[model samples]
Target: MIVITAPTGNIGRHLLPLLLESAPAHGEELRVVVRDPARLPDAVRARVEVVTGSHGDAGVVDRAFEGADAVFWLVPPDATLAPDDAYLGFTRPAAKALAVHGVGHVVAVSALGRGTPVADRAGLVTASLAMDDLLAGTGAAYRALASPSFFENLLEEADSIRENGVFTDVVDGDRRAPLVAVADLAAVAAGLLLDRSWTGTDSVPVLGPQDLSPHDLARIMTEQFGRPVHYARQPLDELYTTLVGHGLHEAFVQGIVDMKRAKDEGLDAGATRTPDTATPTTFAQWCARTLKPAVLS
Candidate 1:
C-alpha cells in the first residue's frame, strides 16, 4: 500500500493520479488520508481507500501506516496559526506513527535551503529542517524533496494581476529565484516513491528550469496573455506595514521579508546545480501551459 496525506491539495491532486498509476505491480492499493472524505472528488474516493482523519490523529496514522510500503508525507499550510508552529507540531505525530508501523520507505515535501544557516531566520525553512530531522531519526528510508518558491504561488494574486496589470513581491525586479511548477514537484515526489532506491536522508533540491526575475515573468505573461504584465517590487517597510494593515501577523510578514533577503542575495540561484543535461520545463512553457489558464480563470 502507498499512503498519501493531503491528497486533495493542488500538488496532491496531481500526485495522486501519478501515484496510482505507479502502484506496485502486485495489486498494491493507494490510500488517501483526508479530513473530510465526502469533500474529496468522486473519482478519487472511488479509486483509493479514504482514511478520514486529521494529521494529529494517532489512531488514523497507525491504521493507515499498516501494510503501507511507502508514504507521501505532506504538512498542509495552516493560515490560522504561525506557519512554523503548524508544521513543527505535526512532526512528533508523524514520527511516532512511522516508528510504530516500522514503515521503510518515505517521501516528504519540504522547502529548499532547509538545512542551511542563511535560511534559518526565514522561519518555515527552519521549521521544515527540524521536521526533516525528526523524520530522519525514525529509522525509515527517507527522501525529503526540498523545493524553492512554488510557481502556483502566483495564482493567489491572480485577481491583483488581472486588475492591476502587475505581480507583487518584495524581491527586486531583477532578482532571480527558482520557480517550480507543482506538477513537476509532484511528479518528482511520485517518481522517488516508486523507485525506492535512495535512502538515509537525501535532500533532493529541484531548481526548476531557471531562476526567474519579475521582469522575465512579466515578459512571459505578456506574450502568453497578450497584455502588459509588469513586476512591482513592494518596498520592505511599506510591504510590512501593508501586510499588518491587512491582518497578517507581524512575525509572519517578517518571515516573508526575510525570505526575500535570501532571494535578493541569490541563494536560490544555485538551482543550476541540477545538471544542464537534465530535462526541465522553461518559464515560457510554464506560462502558456500552466499559468495562462489559471490566470484567465
Candidate 2:
C-alpha cells in the first residue's frame, strides 16, 4: 500500500492518476490523506482508500500508514504558522509513524541548497531540509525531491503580467536559477513511489531543462503572449511589508525574504543539471502551455 498526502495539491492532483493507472499492474493498494475528501475528483475518491484529516495529526497519519509500503509526503504551506511548526512540527509525527509502521519508502517534496552557506539562513529551504533530516532519521528509504522554484509560482502573478506586462520578485532579474514544473516533480515522485527496489536516504534534485533568470522568463512570456513583458525586482523591504500586511507570521516572512536574497546571491546556481536531474520541460514550453493560457484567462 502507498499513502499520499495533499492529494488535491498541484503535484498530488497530477500524481494521483499516474499512480491509479499503474496500481493495477503493480498490484499496489493506494491511500490518500486529505483535509477534505470532497476536494478530490470523483474518479480518485472512488478508487483509493481515503483518510480524511490533516496528515500532521498523529492519529490520521497512524491510520493512513497501516500496512503502507511507500508514501508520498508533502507539507502544505501555511504562512500564518511559524516555520518550525509548519514544517518540522507537522513532519515529526509522520516521521514517527513511518518508523513505527516500518514504511519502506518516503518520497517527500523538499527544496535545494542543502550544503551551501546560504542553506542555514535560507528560511523555507532550511526548514524543509530539516524536515528531510527528521525523515532520514526514521530509517525509511527516503528521497527528498530537492526542487527549486516552481514554474507554476509565476501563475500567481499572471493577472499582473496580463494587465501591466510585468511580474515581480525579490531576486535579481538577471540571476539564473533552476526551476522545475510541478508536473515534472510529480512524475519523478510517482516513479519513485511505484518502484520499491531503491533503499536508503538520498536527495533527488529535480532541475528543469535549463537554468533561467527572471529576465529569461520575461522574454519567454513576451514571446508567448506577443507582448513586451518585463521582470520587476521588488525591494526586499517592500516585499516584507506586504507579506506582514497579509498577516503572515514574522518569521515566515523573514524566511521568505532570506530565501529570495539567497537566490539573488546564486544559492541554486551550484548544482549542474545532468540527464538524470534535468526534467524534460523547459521554461519556454511551460510559458506557452501553462503561463500563457493562465494570463489569457
Candidate 3:
C-alpha cells in the first residue's frame, strides 16, 4: 500500500490521477491520511482507502503507515511566530511513527534553501529542514523534495485581483524567484515512490517555469486577462497588519516579510540543476489555462 499525508491539499489533489494509474497491479493499495474521512471529496474517497486521523497523532500515524510501502509526508502550514519551532513540535511525533512502522520509503514535501541561516526566518524551509533531518535518521529511503515557492501562492491574491484590480505580496514587484507548479512537485514525488534507487536522505529541487517577479506576474495577468493589472506594494508592517486583519497572526506576517527580505537578498535565486522535464507552464500559461477562467466566472 502507498500512503499519503495531506492528500486533500494542492499537490495531493493534483497527484490523484497519476497515482491511481501508477499503483501496483493485483489491488495495490492507495491510502490517504486525513483528520476526517467525511471531508474528503467523493472521487478521492471512492478511489482509495481513507485512513482517518491526524498525521500528528502517533496512534493515528501507526494505523496510517501500517502496511504502507511508501509515504508522501507533509506538515500542515503554520502562520505563527517561530514557525520552525512550532513545526518541530508537530513533525517530531509523526517522524517517530514512521520510524516505528518501518515505512519503506518517504517522499517529504520541503521547500528550497532549507538549511541556510537565511532560511531561519522563512517558515517552510526552516521547518522542513528539521523534518528532513529527523526523517533521515529513520533509515527509510528518504527523499526531501525541495520545491521552489509555488505558483499556488498566486491564489492568495485571487480575491484582491477580482475585487480591486490588483495583486500584492512582499516580493519587490520586479525581483525574480523560482516559482513552480504543484503538479511538477507531485510528479517528482510520485517518481521517487516508483523508483526506489536512491537511499538515505536526498533532496530533489523542483523549480518549475522560470523565475518571475510580481511585475512580470502583473504583466502576464494583464495580457491573459485583457485588463490593466497592477501591483500593490506594502511596507512590512502594513502587510503584517493587513494579514493580521485577515485573521493571521503578526508573527506569521513577520515570517512572510522575512521571506521577502530573503528574496531581496538573493536567498531564493539559485542555479538550475537540469532542464525541467515537468510541464514548465509559465504564469501567463497557468493563468490562461487555470486561474483566469476560474476567477472570471
Candidate 4:
C-alpha cells in the first residue's frame, strides 16, 4: 500500500491522479489522508481508501501509515505558526507513525539550499531541511524534492498583471534562479513513491529546464499575454509588514523575509542542473499554459 498526505493540495492534487493511473498496475493500493473527503472527485473517492483528518494530527497519520509501504508527504503551509512548528512540528507525528508502522519509503516536498552558506539562516528553508532530517531519522528511505520557487507562485499576481501589467517579488529583477512547476515536482514525487528500490535519505533537486530571472519572466509573460508585462521588485521590509498586517504570525512573517533574503544571496544557486535534476517544463510553456489563462480569466 502507498499513502499520500494532503491529497487535495497543489502538489498532491497532481500526484494523486498519476498514482491512481500507475499504482494499480504495480499491484499497489492507494490511500489518502485528507481533511475533507468531498474535496476529492467522486471517481477518486471510489478508487482509494480515505482517512479523513489533518495529516499533522497524530491520530490521523497513525491511521494512514498503518499497512502502508510508501508515503508521499507534503506539508501544507501554516502561516499561523513559527517556521519550526510549521514544518518540523507538523511532521513529527507522521515521522513517529512512519517508524511505528515500518513504512519504508517517503518522498517529501522540500526547498533548495541544503548545504549552502545561507541555508542555516534561511528561515523557512532552514526549517524544511530540519524536517527532512526528522523524517530521515525515522529510518525510512526518504527523498526530499529539493525545489526552488514554483512557476505557479506567479498565479498569485494574476490580478496585478491583468490590471497593471506588473508582477512583484522580493528578488532582484536580474537575479537568476531555477524554478519548477508544481506539476513537475508532483511527477518527481510520484516516480519516487512508485519505485522504492532506492534507500537512504537524500534530496533530489527538481530544477526546471532553465534558470530565469524576474525580468526574464516579465519578458516571457509579455510575449505570452501579448501585453507589456513588467517586473516590480518589492522591498523585503514591505513584504514582512504586509504579511504580518494580514494577521500571519510575526515569526512566520520573519521567516518569509529571511527566505527571500537568502534567495537573493544565491541560496538556490547551489545546485547544478544536470539532466537528472532538470525537469521538462520551460517558463514560457508554463506562462502560456498556466499563467496566461489565469491572468486572462
Candidate 1 residue lDDT tens string, 25-48: 646688889998987778768789
lDDT of each: 0.79, 0.92, 0.76, 0.94
Per-residue lDDT tens digits for candidate 3, residues 1-297, read 888888878888777667888876435689998887886778768889887888877788888888788898888776654565556777777778777888889998876775555777665466667778888888688888877678778877787887887987666887887888788788888778776777877777787767788898888899888888799887777876777888876666666677667766666665464674334767777888777976676
* Candidate 3: count of backbone clashes, pairs at least 3 residues apart or interchain: 0
Ranked by TM-score from best down, the candidates are: 4, 2, 1, 3
- lDDT of candidate 4 at residue 135, scale 0 to 100: 95
| Poorest stretch of ten by lDDT in candidate 3 | 270-279
Worst 10 residues of 4 by lDDT: 186-195
Clash count (model 1, backbone only): 0
Q: How far is candidate 1 from the true structure (C-alpha RMSD, Å)?
A: 2.2
**Per-model TM against the reference:** 0.91, 0.98, 0.91, 0.99
Evaluate model 3: give its TM-score. 0.91
Shift of residue 2 alpha carbon in model 1, Å:
1.0
The lDDT leader among the candidates is 4
Clashing pairs in 3: none
TM-score of 1: 0.91
Note the clash tally of each candidate: 0, 0, 0, 0
Query: Which residue pairs show backbone clashes in model 2?
Result: none
Model 1: worst 10 consecutive residues (lDDT sum): 270-279
Residue-wise lDDT of candidate 2 within 208-290, one digit each (tens)?
A: 99888999998888888988999988999999999999999999999899888887877787777999999998888888898
lDDT for model 3:
0.76
Clashing residue pairs in candidate 4 are none
For residue 159, what is the lDDT in candidate 4?
96
Query: Model 4 off-target regions past 4 Å?
Result: none
